[model samples]
Target: MFDLDLWREIFQSINKNKTRAALSGFTVAFAIMLFTILFGIANGLENTFEKFFLTTADNALTIRSGTTSKPYKGLQIGRLITYANKDLDYLKKEFGDKIQYITPKLSRTYQLKYKKRKGEYTITGVSPDHQYLEKAVIIKGRFINERDVKNKDKVIAIGRLVEKDLFVKESALGKYIDLEGVVYKVVGVFSDNGGDEQERTIYTGYTTIQRLYLATDEIGSITIGYNPNMSADQALVLVQEITAKLKSRYDVAPNDQRAVRIGNRILQEKKRLDNMTTGLGILIPIIGFGTLIAGILGISNIMIFIVKERTKEIGIRKALGASPRSIVSIILLESILITAFAGYVGLLIGVGVLEAIGSSIERYWITNPSVKPSIVYTATIVLVIAGAIAGFLPAKKASKIKPIVALRNG
Candidate 1:
């Protein structure tokens, strides 16, 4: 089925109309380029969102108190609501086995100083499990441990930004810093986050903070890290059950309820981003296929024109004992050759553009935009289908032309 004469004729015909051919090729290439860029952007956004969520926490829940206005079911309004240490103790005593990690935090704003350098930061008094709940990565030294909390040691883990400001050109670990006149030794330095590192924070042991600051038996908030296998809904339900039990035991009204506030918004946002990416993934292929169809149509139109121009040549070949199948094959081959070459060029250009642009747009949510191999393979298949379809109609038409009619036209 490989005819040298057919290939020669197809090549000659395409070479004769280089400008029109180039225009058609450009159309296909441009469409493919647009499709590739769209796919890359969607992919980048999804990756960034995932990274942002991971940097925060994993399978963790947060609890906060909120003011309620209306009295509900015999409960009085305007009550000062708070979740106490006793409530936390009760929850842990009842559901210790079900929980993975728990941290009770007491936060306050204070000026942190080391020698002459001073900056304001949020000072958080947290238990040992706080590091696990927040997924805090210790860049230097070690985070506050159980010994620090148990002994009520005046030790702190500082964020990277705070270390840079308070202890410039020196290791912050083993250095003593003042937190509102209370001396605390820096045990670890954490990574910088969301800019303004010095303005970010430092964490210390809960009992140490309580003892040093003379605020015993009081906590600001509680963060709970549940088992990875547990769903957010399940964690929330457990928190609700714990809250109800605590309220009943304390004889507190529903409006005066001390309840856990689960913070699973990051997970929710991640799921939303994933769904959006999936939709875009489906959409990109449809657009790419549509462009391919248009390119095929252009090839078909050119093939039809080629058939008309070569009518007498085709007729003479037939008259001289050429088979109808051979005549059809020549026309089909020309159309397919043009479409295949143009599609390939388009695909290459599109991929090249993606590679070039992907590097410059790195962010937490939209990093490293690149096309998947599966998508590339699928597009290649589409191009082949387009080439075949583009050639089919023109080949069939050429085969039907009679020698007498074609001769008359010549």
Candidate 2:
């Protein structure tokens, strides 16, 4: 297998025609490098979307009440669709297993005050699962628990902006705060990606809000978490069913689509992701293989020229009884070595370029933008297979070179 003579001949051929050899190698290398970078760009976009979507629960949906837009069953068209504690209970009991976590939202206006600092924020009433819907990170203390909701605890989880504005330099943990002249202890200081306004928001227990402030069953909206494994179609179905149930209970006309507003963000987002994936599926191959096929064609053409140039010499070898298989192997070995070496060079350049800008890309574009080892290995395998295909026709054509044909061509 250690064919020194074959390698020596290969090198001799390259040395004889340096320009042609460089062109051949450069074609392969450029193709690999360009293709690799394009692949990285595709994957980086994918990573960027994944990071953004992960900020919110993949299966989370928010529902808001709306007024009837059409008259039905003796009801006026302007009937307001309202959701309350009992509505949540009814939905929970009706769609028990289908619903993962359902939380009612009742926005309360409070003059947020701690010591001398005071700010006004719409304190939202939420359950423990509200954290999942909002994806808040608790930096100081724990999020709301079931006990806090059930026992009507006078506690709150304020966002980072709230912490900074009200508490200033001091920590807000275990600190008593006033909301609308009522004292409540801060249990957690959280942060979200939703900018300064979102950070200014705070969470209070649903029961506490209803009992202490509103003194009535009044809810502005509801958030429902679907099972993580639910597909876009399934989520759409659930939303339709829930919307129908709510419309029926509230006596909104069946045809009044505006009475019950549903937001299937998970399904919408999933569909968008699927569309993006499909577009990339069509794009990547068209671009990557387009470059690769150019390289392959160049390799094939170069090999054909090499075979043609060596016609007289090959004829002499055939005269000496050299086997056709030897001729085919010789041409194939040279093609493989050229393509493999070019690919390796391209691999180094591609990796170096990515390493240089990886951090900058991740900071702004994607969370982590890097090619996987499997992708590199797959490229290598492609190089080998492409090398074989590039050399195949030339090798076969050269192999069929009868002494007369070679002599005549010469």
Highest TM-score against the true fold, candidate? 2
Q: Write the per-residue lDDT of candidate 2 for residues 1-410, one digit (tens) a residue.
A: 79888788778877887886787788778877877777777788788777767666777788898988988888778878787888888988988877888888888677877888897987988999889788888999988889999998999999998888888899999999988778999999999876777788889888889899778777878888887677677888898898888888888877787889988766687878867877987998799888777766777777778777777767877888988877777777777777788887887787777777777877656445566656755665576677777667766777678888787887
Question: Compared with the true structure, what per-residue lDDT tens digits does model 1 show for residues 361-405?
Answer: 784356877777567546555655665665566656766778888
245: Cα error in model 1, Å: 5.0
TM-score between model 1 and native: 0.67
List per-candidate RMSD values in Å.
5.9, 4.7
Which residue runs of candidate 1 sit more than 4 Å off their true CA positions?
Answer: 1-12, 23-27, 44-55, 58-60, 66-81, 84-101, 128-136, 180-182, 197-199, 225-252, 255-378, 385-410
State residue 239's C-alpha deviation in candidate 1, in Å: 6.4
TM-score of 2: 0.78
Clash count list over all predictions: 7, 0
lDDT of 2 at 172: 94
Estimated TM-score for each candidate: 0.67, 0.78
